[model samples]
Target chain A: MSEQAGYVPVVGAVAEPQPAPEKSYRFSEQAIQELEEILTHYPDKKSAILPALWIAQREYDGYLPPQAIQEVADRLERPFVEVEGVATFYTMYNLRKRGRHHLEVCTCLTCAVMGAYEVVHHLEKRLGVKVGQTTSDGEFTLSEVECLNYCGAATVVQVGDKYFGNITKENVDELIETLRNSNEFTPADLANAIVRLHIPERTAKK
Target chain B: MAETLVLLKHRDVPGIENIDIYEQHGGYAGLKKALAMERDAVINEIKTSGLRGRGGAGFPAWIKWSGIPKDTKKPHYVLCNADEGEPGTFKDRELMLKLPHMVIEGMIIAAYATQSAKGYIYIRGEFVESARSIRRAIDQAYKKGYLGKSICGKEGFDFDLYIHMGAGSYECGEESALMSSLMGERGQPRLKFPHAPLPIHEGVWQSPTLINNVETYAAASQILAHGGAWYATMGTENSKGTKIISVSGHVKKPGNYEVELGYPVLDMIELAGGVTGGKLKAVIPGGSSVPIIPAELCKDFKLDYDAHQVVQYSMRTMRLPVVGSGGFMVFNDKTDIVVLMRRTAEFYTHESCGKCTPCREGTRWIFKILSRITTGGGLPGDIDLLVNICDQIDGRSYCGLGDAAAWPIMGAIKHFRHEFEYWIEHKRSPVGEDCLPPAPEPLNPLLTLTPV
Candidate 1:
């Protein structure tokens, strides 16, 4: 699942119409610099795809939408359809639009064996929207993914940049509320607030 | 009564454990029926069965078999991925030990359907006893005309099966890596290039090979015996037939339990002696690669397909319904979510193969940050820094293995941020205040501290 970080193309078998390419959307200078720096860490050019998409998604509101994947494909020199296949294969690559905040629920074997199905159901029922479908308010989008790699502790999740392992429906609701109420929150603030409950240093910036 | 392979399917056949007993119970009837049918009919039968892989990825078994290019210039080969490396899962071992013949029979039918003259069972090294049993069963099958040429007394259909044991690495669970390992390589993933692309078309000496999980092969026997419709009616609409769940951890009876695909997790837990420890903390629904769900969130979860779609929660890994090897690992209040993560991180790092920079270095970086945080040596910005690194590692790696390493760390920090903070601020675990097990709650893998 999520624990093993090996390099691979988002390999998938998808037959989709290839849209014509357009001019690259100008990423904020900070976003470009940030993504470029991340790419420098990788030895290969294509290795920066997931990170590039992440930056691209965050910079252009939320979600890669098809064009973004294509743009990144062109930039990386990856084939258009092949890049699309990679974009769609993994859950982290968001094809559709999402809320301002994104939440990831782990449904890997450890979590599933530990009861992740109910976690997903509870979140969907609480959000009044099925996973992969954004909320009516666009505050959130529910997506069920495979393992975030916590076999020993099932029912783990990630909201924004913070990971909330050993979570329950009650905690999930609180997390959703915290995100719904707060905008421009740092990863530390949310992590400390919804996860550890009290951590000044980690949340010092906020 | 002794536990045996028959328990996997829960058949009432007498003497199912012994070879003679199994033969007497009409075990090889499917192979007999297979020999009597045309190759395409057998392939079409599997296609009609709606059988997905029993392994974690629910890929269609027949379509995979169909992709072998029967008329290719090269001979098509069959490979069984018996490498059960998923954490909190061990259903394949029991099946291999108990019903090796079932796998053999299924392989025979598949060989006939795909016209594969040679077959190999790639089992894990940890399964010593199971491998022995499987080897014995293969020998027995050979003597009885099921494995060798003129199998079941039919002419011109020669097929041979061999069991290849792995050196025990989780990455090898991946098909391309598994093929590489079977061919005596380092067991790392390969890239799919244009023109010379696709692992299936060229695996193990570059042959058009068909690879299936062990359990999927076993399903072939049932499809041959009872037909696809019978198999289809057993599970959910999209998910057909029963699955054997290797239930372990936090349950009284931690063993493999055969179940219909649509059963509830609660029912499955109850079958395994419900809640050995009080206040269920979390549950790993699939294998270690899938995310964990806390007990409260899992109140209504049913252990079936479509119910626990991982993509909803940002989980991208596939959870095969234990087709290759069924296994389920459960966690309770005593389990430390953080310490578990730290341990899991160590596994991925140790097995990283160091192929890609993001993954090779990322797994190490994640572990290092986690180690620093868990051992009270964490800097204030370490958590964010760790998340930031995992963020890059998530989709940047060559395969899903990189995501596997990054997602757990990401999920752990999200749910158990206090543990990391405490390790940094107080150099202690959060369980000190909570009413834990008799003494202290076991260390969470993410938050576990290295001894000073």
Candidate 2:
């Protein structure tokens, strides 16, 4: 069942071979400053791994390639395999490349009963791709997610940082069109929002 | 009874998320009251209120609050479990989004009572909007001196709160696993008491820590603000205070409703504009982890910790529903019990952290068997096999996730055995053509080519 429906890689999948560490670090100076400030929030640099990976996801543009994982390990002074283990254990951290917009429809129990599958089938038809595949233009990637926890708005479709709720097969096309023209809710933006949350406003303002 | 507005009282107020508006609406009054009292006095207030943990366990709040060592040599930490990943729950999401200050104020009060120097709100990563609201509130609190060193001019009372974002792991909602995730490890459960010391003694960084659900902390703030005795006036003898029920699924008015504990289950259904589409069928009174109650049994139940216990005693069965985390999900007559249980099984399978053998391997097997049955490959023994699998996984697992995965399936089979038998004998859903969760497509294309 997971072979077809599961879009995110199963957690704790064996780590792929790491790219050579010779590539220069890609994190900009501001990103470095943000990481340094985040370090102060926790006692050890190791606790900063989750936030560092979020920054890596942002810096690497959407998904964490091997180079991005290496950059995070190098920055935190941890083992590459150790960082990869943490990254792979989480479903939100995309291991492979994704389209500019990742459409995650909640197909958990409440959403399922409320016609979440119809929404999924509609998106597949509109995008001309199956559940886990990206559109031809690399604009949209469709996948069924576990409960986004907004079940009151069943059939909640998460587009990056934003959650479009009360969606159905009928209104999903309007949402897709809106997402097609907007770039604010990309995977990078999702990572950026999570990263900024860790840094206190007092520190961020300065 | 009607919806009682306590935590959500000022939820719809304009600019309530801001410090100024929140302060004007009697915000931080609880912190002021708590700061004036002795540390033990603050705990005494909570004890008076009889408030239990709203994070599903229903453990008494005062026991955990007073559990922290008074003369601890190590630094104490207060952690808020804001990762609301329960399938049918979104109350914490709304609380954090609308009443961020209330949650923060409660955390501050907890830090004061526990004498903790540091705290963290480990929110799930999908809740970026909620996290943003909390971020703004925390910044405002720091600016107003509600947080940081010498809070509100109290000497030797310094508290620092930080936001730790989880990367989409439901297992982190478990307390020990939450600490594991906070320290940047795999979000897996640790051995519990009798096997290991409780988290209050040796927790994150080997320090005494106090962890409470988002609703628990928010209720703490309210309990402190109004004296515990005043707060105790509502609810049943054992259960006190109002609980925010996240009503969804086949309900006409699906949203978060903060109703007092001991409210009738049937009344709650009506409160949410009654069930939509058809007659009421079943209700998962708690989150998906608890047992699913057939509509006939739901009438006598009340929304409280002890009421659920009464249900178990009357039925003479251990597998009964509870008011768990207040994720009230109502289903209509058109819903198919077998199909709903299949989706429920799939959720637990996807979320099992693989920390223990019983949960990791068992959840997969359960899903596999259910999928097979749903796809028209059910053996006559499949029903008993599913029960056997549930029994093995129930008490044997490391944490509650295994039990959570087993209970609903067990509950479904207990109440709707006929549905399972019909499916096995007829090779079709008993609900017929319009059944929800529509039948699963066969995993193999060739199987679809052949007729049932």
Candidate that scores best on lDDT: 2
Per-residue lDDT tens digits of candidate 2, residues B1-452?
67899899999999999999999999999999999999999999999999999999899999999999998599999999999998899999999999999999999999999989999999999999999999999999999999989999999899999999999889999999999999988899898898988999999988899999999999999999999998899898989989999999999999999999998889999999999998999999888988888899888899998865321222235635489988899999988888888888888888899888988888888888777777678889988888888777877867899989988888788788898888888888888867764533433332211010
Report, for candidate 1, the interface RMSD. 18.1
**TM-scores for all predictions:** 0.63, 0.94
RMSD of each: 21.4, 6.1
User: What residue runs in model 2 are displaced by over 4 Å at the alpha carbon?
Assistant: A1-22, B309-321, B437-452
lDDT of 1 by residue, B1-452 (tens): 11223226534454455578777766887888888999888888888888888777787787777777767587767888888767666566666767777888898898888777878787764445566667778777777777778877778788977655554356777887777666544567777445355655787668777887877888888788778777777778877777777776677777677777767766777787877766667666666555556676666666665654332123344332222234566677766666566656765765665668899898878777766665557788887788778767776766778877766566566656776787788865565523211111113343221100
Error of 2 at B355 (Å): 1.5
Global lDDT of model 2: 0.88
Top DockQ hit:
2
List the lowest-lDDT window of 10 residues for candidate 1 chain B.
B433-442
Evaluated at residue A48, the lDDT of candidate 2 is 92
lDDT of 1 at B99: 79
Residue A155 C-alpha lDDT in model 1: 68
Q: Give a tens-digit lDDT track for model 2, residues A1-206.
A: 34766467667786876557676689988899999999998889899999999999999988898889899999999998889899999999989878899998888889988999888877877898877778889999887788899999997989899999999999999998888888564989999989999888778844
lDDT of 1 by residue, A42-75 (tens): 3356645544555555554555666777777766
